[model samples]
Target chain A: MTRQFLRHGWTAGLLAILALLFVFTKIIQPDFGTSGLDSLSRAMLPFAFATAAMAVVVIAGGIDLSVASMMAVAGVTAAVLMDGAGDGMTAVAVVIVLLVGLTMGAINGALIVITRVPDIVVTLAMLYVWEGVALLILNGPGGSATPWLRELIVGPFIVPWLPRSLVFLAVCLVAVWVPLKRSKLGLSIYAIGSNDLAAYRSGVSVGRTRIAAYAVCGLFAAIGGLTLTMSTGNGEPIPGPYLMASVAAVVLGGVVLGGGKGALLGPIIAVIILRLVRMDLTLLSVDPNVTTIVEGTIMVVVVMFGGVLAYRGRHK
Target chain B: MTSETTMFKSVGRFIGNNPLVPLLILLLVLVGVLEFMRPGIVNERWIGNTIKFAIPLAMLAACQTLTMLTGGIDLSAAVAATISAFVMATQVPIVGVPLAICIGLIPAIMIGMVNGFGVAVCRVHPLIMTLGTGLIATGCLQVYQRFVIASGSVIPDGLAWLGTGRTWGLPNALILFVPIAILIIWAQRRTGFGRLLYALGSNETASRISGVRSWQVFLALYMLSGLIAGVTGLLYVGLIKAPSLSLVNPLLLPSVAAAVIGGTSIFGGRGGYSGTILGALILTVLGTLLTLLQMPEGLRRILFGLIILTVTTTYIRLTEQSR
Candidate 1:
């Protein structure tokens, strides 16, 4: 039990920090109740999903610079279709947008494999490509989502205490992450990430695992996009800011950037903490620019701290 | 096979071994296409304009090329450039142009040194380290803008002339690029430090074992990257005739893309400024062509993305095949 606790100490520490921030926000704003929590969840869902998407890719020893762009593409596609096809076709529109995200991810994966190029290079290029596609789909961010879709995504849950966004996140955790993390494919991803040549020698399918990781990442990115569309009721062609936010969340979550280590829980907690910190700052009437500075500082500090920990552990 | 077939095979081999061949071919093709699109794109005025626009990017790409050669990257490069430009613009009023320009380099140099310390001494990944510093720089700039620097400060006339003025039928920026290019090429080929950089980049452990101080090399390279970014920012202010926060934001990714397209492997080692120069030119030409076609911004971005993808993939495949 102690070994297990120590093993996940970083994640535990993050959870504690999140709890502290939550309490701090509530203390600062006494009116911050269920309604405030609901809005916070709604605002955080996209970034939480994005962090998860990035975590998966990073764990697979690749980084996807296009995740935010994928979100934009998916959001724009859904928004345009929802606006044009009406509420009756919401399901079909979502399916198509999800397919778009998957296709984009597959293209990234295929290009990385076929060209033998670095993941960063391939994804960076795709980031621009998808952003362009998003802009092409919605030139100025005017498309709207159907009310039904919005309710389905961002509405309160059937149970009064739970928000739909939280429910959705829980579902994702239970349905996708829990199962995938214990699966053969997941193990293969870890193996390949830690050392691709060794994994290949040991009969793991490095290429396929990498592609699958990216596909999963894309699926989550699409979810993030849908959530953004639902919450905002519109599509934003420029989703560049979310890219850094997602990365920051991943780092804060205790995920190793070099690959082969990390859990989904860290990023989820990190996301909430990040949002709560913003909420706290807003309640305190801090400057908006300070938010970016704080976020960046946290990212650096967490990464540096992690580096030190890893170094000490190795040497010790 | 006949002798003719053998000759063809050898020629194919030659092209395969040399990464620059395809880049040159691509450049020629782009030039031809641009000329076709606009009947007089081949003329001096247009070409000069293209090179003029490319100069900043070329310099930025050179900065990227240096760090990339050392297996590191500077995501904050554009921000670093912006900070320097902001400093120069704000300080020129108080300190005059020459001293302000010299003072402007301080922030860039300091930031680069900090990035070097983090990466070389602390062993943080370059991406995260530079990103953190970049955020700090940007935040500081925001604070500076909000509190200190008044808006609407014009660039000094001397610097503006160097930026826009031509000498002996060449754009001054281009003229400046000549010495910068020559210096980099010469340093890379002739200096002991240059050899150490390649050695450290190619195999850090081996180099460490063989008496190369990897940290020193990393420090120097990162510092050089910062200095170049500072110089690029100064020139950029001249070119744009003002310093804005977002002045060099768009160039960040393009600079990295240019370095990659120029055959600088992002992983480290095995690339040069010469290739980056060509890459910058090609990108400038592409941008010019896109504008001449009056393509919408969305389509233009999509085209640029596609070009980066296609060119990079082709180059990677060619190199893999040759190997």
Candidate 2:
């Protein structure tokens, strides 16, 4: 029972802190009531999807540092394709955008499985290779996402109260979390993450499962990337920082780096909390530098705590 | 059995066992292709200058190989290099050039120590820990750049010569390469430290059980990696004669890639610096050839990605086949 409590405690703690931050920010900055919430949601919405994508891979016991790069590549691909489509092929280009995302994801998954390289190294390499590829494609093309597409991505959903991107975000959460409950593949992922050799003994195809997990991660990243393109309406050369931010979200969300243990919703909240951290810092007029320091301190401390947890768990 | 015949067998065995052979073959292949496309591409000037450009990267790859050998990756190597470059450039004018170079090693050693402590003593994973340090280093870069702005600083002309100046028709950068390569080779083949690294890489648990002090080895390896990155960064700054932060982007990929292709197992254990140097040379030549081919940067990148994917796959397949 106590173990379960500790398991849930990571997410609960972040939630509590998030609530405090939101409330405090609201109180201090009178302007934060509605617009702040909107900004908060706006800032977090795309990352929310990205975090979900990160969570799937993390839960499977691998890390995808390339999520940001995939997002960048996919986003740029979609934008450039849309731009080049010349109005007649806009719909076809959108389909192409999603397809390119899938292709990129497959590449990531394929490379990880075949090379058997550490996920970090493989993904870090992919992050560069893909981003370089994206930059080369864009090549200072200076394209923009369409107005309608931007509106669909940025505007409110049917409720007219929540962001439109929140709809896709909802679909993403359901798509992942639902299957996680229903599918043996999901359980096997958790098993593989916990102990791959043991999982292999238990009749799971570790390589296939891992590849699938990375593909799903790629898919999520691509989706996130396309959404971000629609929201921002531009392609970017530098996508690593934002990608690292998502990585920070995954780690902060209590997904253990070596894999096999973490909740889905935790990363979502982590993304929000991280965005809020930035928002709160901005609200309080704290130096953004302090935020970096705080973030680094938090990552090092959390990773240490995770080590402690794993150490104690092992001994126990 | 005759000693000469026995020696021949050992020499053949070493060639067969060494990772450098494959990388050398790759380099030869690259030269062949470049020559095929444009004859005399491997002329004395081209070869010497290529080696000069290749040295800083090769040094960095050697450091990366050592860290990766111990089952850790040093993402901060580039940042370390960048910081060192910035520091060297900034300090050389204030202090004497030689003194500036020596002082610059301090930051690299310190960053390395921090990485070592965090991973060894703190028990933090190298990735997260170095990432934090990497970020801190990046911030320091920004801070130092701001300092440069405030102080109106510039790297000294004499120090800049370390990058550009040549000796006996050979670039000074190439001079830095030989000693570093010798030291890396010595560390790997002629030392207890190399054995400890191999043992740690092969089996950390057994190595620890056998009293190898795996953590200490890790600490030392990380420190070495950092120190090497620092020197590499200095060389880079000297070469460019300015601290270009963008260099980190290209450096990170190729450094890690060179180590991998040079036949260093990314999983750690079972590789050498000789292969890393050869790998760096091959990759540098490949990139240069791509430019020479007049390929658009985009096509070149796509091709580079394909090459990486192909190389890693081939490396894995070859190992599997051997097993």
Candidate 3:
């Protein structure tokens, strides 16, 4: 319906703006274009996975603030595992990263369900805990991945223009999208997020669905972490704060903070918009420190606009 | 049942019922652990300086807690503090220190009013509205000071002495915080406005239905937060004697952590200032202990983040278990 399209007009508009800025940045900062685009693609890939992961949770009416932190956990775990093992151990390490993400997310979901604490608190606490665990494990930063494993996983390829990270992200999106659009599990997730009580009454497995959503969130965060390590060629503990930024991005992307509104495209667009803002700030020669203020302001404004629109739509 | 028996039973129930008793006990245990970790950490100098360092955060927490108590957050406290710091830095020598401090308080209060108006009158979510105010305040400071104020600049000896002065082995800031705390506690417990806030926080619709002027109360609470943030800025001037924009963002979380850790429910209502003060002490002491241990910055960050997570998770678990 045209009404449905109108409902998502803000998202479409933001995506267009982002596309323009991407080109504009390319024109203005052509020197850093290849590297920046590479970096953006690399950086955006993981968050893209996170966005997909967050999409499900949001559809279920929960927000996952622990994605970035969980990503750190997975990345650190993967790197640490790779460092300790022989060349043959890379596949095993990758599997372990996925498992850790699922476990962490499961804990998040279980806590949220059992305690009835707000998702914000649950996710915030997890963000800190996982980051600490990452720090505890990594000790500092820069865990080494096996050279061959790194080559295969993160190395540049000739056949396709797409980076491995891009392929990984695309695969994740397909993996999530196909099941989500086609499966009963996806419907259950939406049902639970929209109204837990209603979903429960309707015989949906609220606890299992929420747990699954969180597990998926964790899995995505890991993929993001791996992508980040591959791009940076080093692990930096600093991106710990970005977990919240990712959440803000998701919210800005048009995903409703309270769970069951918005689409995958919204957060993907939101991330691009945020990246564009950062790129613009860089173009303007603004102090990087001030970027925090700008990013926070943008997030708050976007959420406020979303809130107002939601309020109006309901009342109207 | 006889009246005497019923009275005895009620008294027994009251003895067992207060939430503050358990919270206080928990706080004491945590403080004890910190003291044990650092031998003589509770010594006179350590105690004095910790309280002194905690004063600005405590004051900010008091104001922030008041807003949170009203079902809103005051994100502009840090910015208001920066603005006040900027005013004190620029104006202290021009206008005498006393007048300068008074001038510093003005913008903070005004900023608070703006937050109140936006949220209460404009119907903006407190998070978004205050964030906007925070940006404006940050910009005002950034633009006014041109990014950084020079360190160790001359301030009035009299004002600097107030910052450095001690009474009963307590830094003036710490001593100053006590009376403010007392006054706040009095205001919260005895005043009509305080009751109005609790009423509003517990249920806005019920309060609105009951004829409480919720908007005016909201405005006052937010304005009060700004006033406190201004005071915090003035204290920072005395302590550091420079307005550093770097201090603004860091203070925001620690203040929230102090308020929340001290048993102020993020949901609003069911809390008091004493808890926030205790929470401030806990955080200040934790920082002191980490520094005394000579922990690296990264490690300290890791520890701080872990401790906050641990405390918050424990709080969540405890609250959930109780329910």
lDDT of each: 0.85, 0.76, 0.73
In candidate 3, stretches whose alpha carbon ends up further than 4 angstroms from where it belongs are A22-36, A43-59, A63-68, A84-87, A146-167, A177-182, A284-297, B1-12, B15-17, B31-43, B90-114, B121-124, B128-164, B209-220, B240-243, B285-323
Candidate 2, residues A85-142, lDDT tens digits: the string is: 5555766777787677767777787888877766766776677677777787777645
Q: Which one wins on DockQ?
A: 1
Better of 1 and 3 by TM-score: 1
lDDT string for model 3 (A284-308, tens) is 7987657666876776656656666
| 1 versus 2: better lDDT goes to | 1
True lDDT of residue B134, candidate 1: 89
Among the numbered candidates, top lDDT falls to 1
* Model 1 lDDT per residue over B234-257, tens place: 889999986888888889999999
C-alpha RMSD by candidate, in order: 2.5, 3.2, 4.4
Q: Fraction of the real A/B interface contacts present in each candidate?
A: 0.57, 0.33, 0.15
Higher-ranked by lDDT: 1 or 3: 1
Error of 1 at B262 (Å): 0.5
CA deviation > 4 Å runs, candidate 2: A81-96, A114-129, A132-137, A153-168, A237-240, B1-15, B95-99, B245-249, B319-323
Off by over 4 Å in 1: A84-87, A153-161, B1-18, B149-152, B321-323
DockQ, ranked from best to worst: 1, 2, 3
User: What shift in Å separates residue B12 of candidate 3 from its native position after superposition?
Assistant: 4.4
